[model samples]
Target: MAAVETKALNGVKLKKKEHRNAYATMMYMGTPRDYEFYVATRVLIKSLVKLQVDADLVVIASLDVPLRWVRALEEEDGAKVVRVENINPYTGQQKRFKLTLNKLYAWSLVDYERVVMLDADNLFLQKTDVLFQCGQFCAVFINPCIFHTGLFVLQPSQEVFKDMIHSLETGKENPDGADQGFIGAYFPDLLDQPIFHPPLNGSNLDGQYRLPLGYQMDASYYYLRLRWRVPCGPNSVITFPGALWLKPWYWWSWPVLPLGIEWHETRRQTVGYAAEMPVVIIQSIIFLGIIVMTHVARPAISKLYYKNSDKTTSMMQTAIKFIEIWSILAAYVVPFAIIPRTIHPLVGWGLYFLGSIALSSVAINSFMLPAIQVFVPLIGIFGSLLVMAYPWYNNGVVRALAVFGYAFCYAPVAWGSVVKLLARLHVSVEREQFFPKLTESSPPSGVNKLC
Candidate 1:
């Protein structure tokens, strides 16, 4: 009886130890990007589960993160939430990264034997279960001298957490006033550490080690070669540490960063786009209706523009030209407002193109403008997008110069299109034949009937 009881106790203890490691990410609120990052965090967690990683998925959310988002992370994404108070040790940080210091709470996860802290922008290419076997403090040196905190293995200790908090209170030497700089300052010697290689027998390591660049492959590297060729370690994860706007979740980043499609692909397979699909469907319907209605009612709309007097004709022409130009401008601006901010990039761009065509149709039909001439702005916008998205530019300087060259080449064509549009407007106004000639005998000389 005594031996059986001891065995049962040991079984319970072993079971408890099973969940001692977690793959962790942080979340905080009070930014316009809060929801974007929340969705990104969910995708990251779901991707980890999809990869069949052996460790628990954890979200170290701040107190202000919405309860609904927390529940979704817990129930839908299969992540364990650890709510921590937002740590604002640096009061002078930029608003964009103000809450990033909250990531320091990953060090307080004492229940986990090892935690692989991550940023929401990380895209895991495969299971990196071996990272759990690394030492108390292991990070990839994506830069030559700085170890990235985007993904790092850390052993949770109350003493360490307290020391870090105390250091914050006392003003640690943080250059950027964000978690990355503070943590980099905290572990300044990680660059000198030996590279971590998981033991074949799967035993855990004991001290800090430098993870190879393959683990935190920077997305910019792919822009140069259009592929990844990290020669060391397993190519486990990719991190987008560049401009905030180009983060993988944003739709505009798709063709600009081709790998963004991969992120959205994982999202589609896992959490899916149910949250934003309704908006996309409605927008599509509206655009299609505009295209059809404008085509069908072209004659009726054009008849309203004709006038008899020269002053009225000149004013009408000016008004029509202004409306056409503004309509073209609205075609470019309206789509950015209507498309769901976090919808898949392909869908967003599709809606944008469709919206541009649909809106441009109004101008095309009302003024009897040529379709090709009216769409010059749309064509120019597409050409500019292509120029900006070109992947082979040797550097940003070259990319900027290429864009300048394209704009320089395109300016004359744009001006010529405008000239053609003005000339076309003159002919249409003079002819007054955009619709069948008004049968009412021109409303008597010198008298104007404004429609």
Candidate 2:
């Protein structure tokens, strides 16, 4: 086990438990670049733990770990560190993906009946007492689950995990490559109304907008952020899911927190600054090129742009323009380099072959699904066995065997997709061939200009 990042948390929960069930996430890698996110989540979560909510809140991970190991603060007084030694990523194989699935496999052994899984950034304001009241799987999330990772609850029954793994294997033969497709497959009933921030009162600030912006999906992946443009007052107690997981060099000035919201800034100093660098000094600048307001830095900078009437709005507009440009540029790049051979076989035969097998796998299982008592754990066992098997393979001779199995399983429907990828990647481009079927009628007026 590794050290728990105050930011990431995971687990499933159900309603009606005397004490809340929980799990904290810890990543194995520790790089210096992770500092900003570190400081942000630390200040945020520490506040919640400090609240001393009732029940034994155990911070499970690395019993006694040292990061830079500042001797004076080497140990925290109240936080308890623990390491889980029995976890495995892949159950039945020696491969990495298998190891990954191995850990999620632990859900089968959880002690609690009702479990509420939340991300670490989810700071509970009022005791989430109502969470334990519901009977089915429910989530209390800030509206829009785009990039949100916290506040979802589930009643783990092993069957859900099993179906997810099966879906993962099915996707390997389809468009998606793994079980993530199956994550919420069995829990569709719980997907309708996740818990939220704004209570839809219809008259509140920003008038019923939710918090966090983690709901938008990008191609095959889920993006980060839960709410945007949400308005909030000062000193408000709300846990923060990651708002901008994209890189800073993206040029666009995306929202750090919501626009009108006064997010509490942590008091800690940022990572680095050099005294000799002029950009490092901000407190002294006034206006124009001068450090004092004589020509440079009033309010912030009035004299330099004093005569420009639209300066304030220009700054804001410029910021918005960069974001729009970045978004446009990002659209052109291949977000995912899908394997050249696709799964839909009309364009190619391999995918159809594989997809046929996948359909059969499901068809065989469907007969069981109609009978709940048998299908539930059967899905779990079925999925877990796949993870242990580590069936997916790479592109070598061994991988070729896996691919053959993959093609045999899904190619009937997916071969066309594979052919499209090959054509796009390897075929030569001719102007007419690339731009076929173009007939442009010259428009007479501005009204005829259609985008």
Candidate 3:
């Protein structure tokens, strides 16, 4: 115990024993799949080292992490690995949450006097070791004014760990099914306190410290910083939270996201960079093809159908038809491609459906009734499916069978729609030819034909 204290004392003398600081993170895959945790951790440690952080680096990983990753963390990154058993705090109602409950183990890392616990997805832009001086439980505010758990300062204690476990076992439910909710419940008054840090708090330098807003920036903020001139220059760390798809490591995010560049920088240093522009180009081409098919191709085909109809095409009619087609394209493209950046995706979709219904009402009422609406749509559906399925056929016999099957389904529907449209046109022509004469013909009102 004396020897242990001596080592602890030496660590303290190096950076102030009571002020010993470390950056820690937690990882638990829960299920087997490709994840960005290892790569993100490597990048994070590298960033800290680059910034010359005067602190120990630690990662509390669940034992489920592969042996190779454990070695990478210890041997390659020079991080202390604290392996713990995975536990599921959520059982009955929220069993699937599996909300990295193992993170609570960070509180038990008593070796370090103060630790800045970070989410695996956090990337440091500059030195944040100054955060070690902050008081316990400092975190930046996210939505609804709650301090985000993504990056926070906390003092480690076995007592706090035992208390948290006690709360968990005693059915003290965490509404968010994660450490954030539980920690928030424990430190509800943290928001009310005046935090030190004159740049962040503007007044307090002697009291507690609140996390600066810039430190836990979401990657989306980078876009705002670019376009709208939002401040991002002073930020020390950036946190990638919300959804898995939003992470920078994914290949699809490379084109527009700034974090993609950061991720690539880390990869180039740690794992040697591979040229992914070809892959990105191919993906972009495929995505563009889908957009063209849905917007430009579908609308152009509908316009051709209208033009080929056996009716006198007037200038007004042509203009209306163009408007109708443009509306369809707008309905398909605007909400998905444009509006989601400004507002919620669900709201965008609502606007899309509403606009589509309003714009298509005239077209639907004019032809859909007599044109066999159900059959026309069925023909379109099967035709598209057949076209998509055509490239997959390898065998001649199977290809022939599929072609026959598609023809069998589509021919009748097409024929029915054409026949119905022609009959309706014929009826209209007959009515136009006779209606004027009937109106012009005078009947003898005085003479009773019945008599």
Candidate 4:
């Protein structure tokens, strides 16, 4: 135990001997969208190579990360990729942050004498090799005396990793619901350590294990200046501490902080900007065509039907009404087409379901249009009853209950549609953009009225 402690403590200093050290980061690409982390991690490695850092660069990534990305890290960037099984135990309100447990696994890489762990969102501005010499569990102060886990140095050991797992298994609560909170609790006095370093070539150790404040500059501080504080750089790395959405890869973020340009340039070189965006463009085009056809073609056809019909005037009017209603309902599917790639799965499915319902309703209305005005209310009531009661008769109680419960949920939508239909019945049609009103008295310009 004494020797273990001594070795662990000795690993922290910039001793005059060759030591196995690594600049490490953990990435969890659990979903397709998480591929952004792969891009960001690649940028970090690019920065390391560009600066000619001496230590080994290592990535501890989730097993789900694509093999090609792992290969790129190893072959292109010359970094070591350590794939690990992601065991997520946090299941509280902050379930999203549960993946931070993957980051804690870095302490289990017992091969490295000392490891400097960084978050994937960090951008290296200057060579941060000096962090390698820092003491065990050294980190920058987030608040007055609280350590920020975005960038930190520590001795890797099986014992620490086991203890972390044990703590979690034993129900040790982490207020932050992530690695930073667990770490802050584990090493409460981490702030007492020496500050990482002073500005290039400034001074020596002050016996404190803390790193210099500049090593992990609060990116939010760059924008808000909450305390009216300027960046105390020459910063070694800039850590994006808040929302991942604020990261530099997003083009819209350019106006707020041009730092994203640096990240974008790095990405363009490594992965290139030609990504899944083109698919979104194709989808946008398809939806645009649908919108144009709905506005132009459907109305024209409806107007023709209204003009040509002799004894079936009511039937023609119903067809025209169906076209107008169906076109407006179909427009719901268009908004999602703009950024199809980024939309949530549930939301995308919702729009799809809505358009399908609208199309089906149009089909039914076209067949029963002249009679629909009489049966609309009955159809809704009987439809609700059949949906709920059929499941109950078959002894599928859960399905029946779900059907019954969801019926009331649609009351608002049904009421709104009823109101809208009534209003449309009372008002005369116009030759406007969406609701084109073509009356016998006043038809479209240069076009005869449908008599």
Instruction: Name the candidate that leads on lDDT.
Output: 1
Global lDDT scores for all candidate models: 0.72, 0.31, 0.54, 0.56
RMSD, candidate 2, Å = 25.8
Tens digits of per-residue lDDT for model 2, 68-166: 422211143232223332222222332222222223332432444444443334433334432333343443334443222344434445665554444
Model 4 TM-score is: 0.57
If scored against the real structure, what TM-score would every candidate get?
0.76, 0.35, 0.51, 0.57
Model 4 is weakest, by summed lDDT over 10 consecutive residues, at 220-229
Better of 3 and 4 by lDDT: 4
lDDT of 4 by residue, 1-451 (tens): 0011223222222212233888888777544447666777878888877788877788887777788888888898878877666656666535446577677767876777778888877777666665565555666666775667777778787777777777877778777777878788888755444444433222333533333455443211111101111122244566667665566654333323334455556556655545655764565455455545543554344443233222434555566666656644453444434344323233333334344344434433322222243234445644554454342243345554656675777677577766756455434232221233355434345332211
What's the lDDT for candidate 3? 0.54
Q: How close is candidate 1 to the true structure, as a TM-score?
A: 0.76
Using TM-score as the yardstick, the better of models 2 and 3 is 3
Model 4: how far residue 407 lies from native, Å: 43
Ranking by lDDT: 1, 4, 3, 2
**Which residue pairs does candidate 3 place in steric collision?**
12-17, 195-208, 196-208
Tell me the spans in candidate 4 whose CA falls farther than 4 Å from its real position. 1-19, 29-32, 93-95, 200-235, 277-442, 446-451
